[model samples]
Target: MPDLEDLYREIILDHYRNPRNRGELDTPPAVRAEGFNPLCGDEVIIYVRLANGVVDDIKFGGQGCSISQASSSMMSAIVKGRTTDELHRLNRAFKSMMSIEPDPDDPAPVNGNGADIKLGDLEALKGVVKFPVRIKCATLSWHTLIQAVEEAQTTG
Candidate 1:
């Protein structure tokens, strides 16, 4: 388990140092949202393009700590080409894993034994919950992503 945790750390660091999708999209994006953690000065901007109810493309630009930057990078990679529904599920799962309580009405599965409950590389972030202070660092981009996608659905 420790080895796996180390691997997860390595993955996070790699993404932070060499982020993926760390740029603005050339095409006009369907929606964009910015996230800021005033406590630590973490900021992120998310750009999303939806097509046929799918996340056709996504990108992010941000300046922050390793956790924040890596979270945004990993989020962009995971959400690309996923359906809006899938993105919502992912958002719920991620938040729950980070110890964020879910609303009673939120149908988002919380690590239930469902076929769709896979977290993939995003699982690397589950450990952030251990450090409550760092939880926001890891979640800043994810929350921004949800905001961007929901806003896009409303306007698109």
Candidate 2:
């Protein structure tokens, strides 16, 4: 059997190879946000459409390393149909997962509300924290998603 790390690596590679929600949405109805990481030259563009405070649709486009692209792909799949509050909680949970030191006894991390957030395939990215610089690569799309949602709130 493959080790957990090997499974995670395969998951990341699968997303990178066949990204989900890989495209663009029309702007008048969708809020677009772009994030660039100069350290690694990973760029991600996120388009989000909100309806009744829910993510009506979401898509992503960009070019970067496997981590960034895979992360954006995973994020797009996870965020669609989620409410803005849920998205925020997920963002917090993902970011927290990226930053927190791993504890052998504590495998799961909670969001601000102290509730366990099931990360799904996103759990594949937990290993990214081992490389400090790659954490930004993993989170670029998430930050852009937050920006797009905030923009939608201000303008819509």
Candidate 3:
């Protein structure tokens, strides 16, 4: 069996090479947000459409390191058709998995027990916690996603 690291590397490369939910939404019925990592010049733009408090669709566009790009791609795939509440939970779980400190003011419940969070393919990014510099790379898209969601909530 391949080691966990090797498997994660393969998953990350696959997403980077063939990103899912890439590109932009054609019309204005969507919310968009961008995130940039000045240190690495990595940028990501997230486009989200919410319907009835659920993510109707999501896509991303930008250029960045393999980690950032892949994480965005994976995020897009996981978020589609999920409710805003679900996104909050998943976002908190993803951030925790990356060992990022939760914002005290944020209402998302992040109970540190990984076993309670069902990350699925997003788990491939857990390795990022070991590399402090790359953690930002992996999380840039997530921050952008949250912004997009907030934008959607406010507008509609």
- Global local distance difference test of model 2: 0.87
lDDT of each: 0.85, 0.87, 0.88
Clashing pairs in 2: none
Local accuracy of candidate 3 as per-residue lDDT tens digits, 1-156: 369889989999999999999999854698889999998999999999999999998989999999999999999999899988888888888888888776666656767644586877789988788789999999999899988888888888
The regions of model 3 sitting more than 4 angstroms off are none
> Which tens-of-lDDT digit does each residue in 1-156 have in candidate 2?
359999999999999999999998999799999999999899999999999999999999989999999999999999899988788777778877887433233223343533388878898998999999999999999888888998999999
TM for every model, in the order presented, reads: 0.90, 0.90, 0.94
For residues 1-156, what per-residue lDDT tens digits would candidate 1 score against the true structure? Answer: 999999999999999888999888754555778999998999999999999899998989979999999999988898899988788787777777788864455445545633357777778998888899999999999889988877887888
Q: Which of 1 and 3 is the better model by TM-score? A: 3
**lDDT of prediction 3:** 0.88
Consecutive 10-residue window with the lowest summed lDDT within model 1: 106-115
For candidate 1, the TM-score is 0.90
| Worst 10 contiguous positions by lDDT, candidate 3 | 106-115
Candidate with top lDDT is: 3
* Model 1 misplaced stretches (Cα beyond 4 Å): 103-116
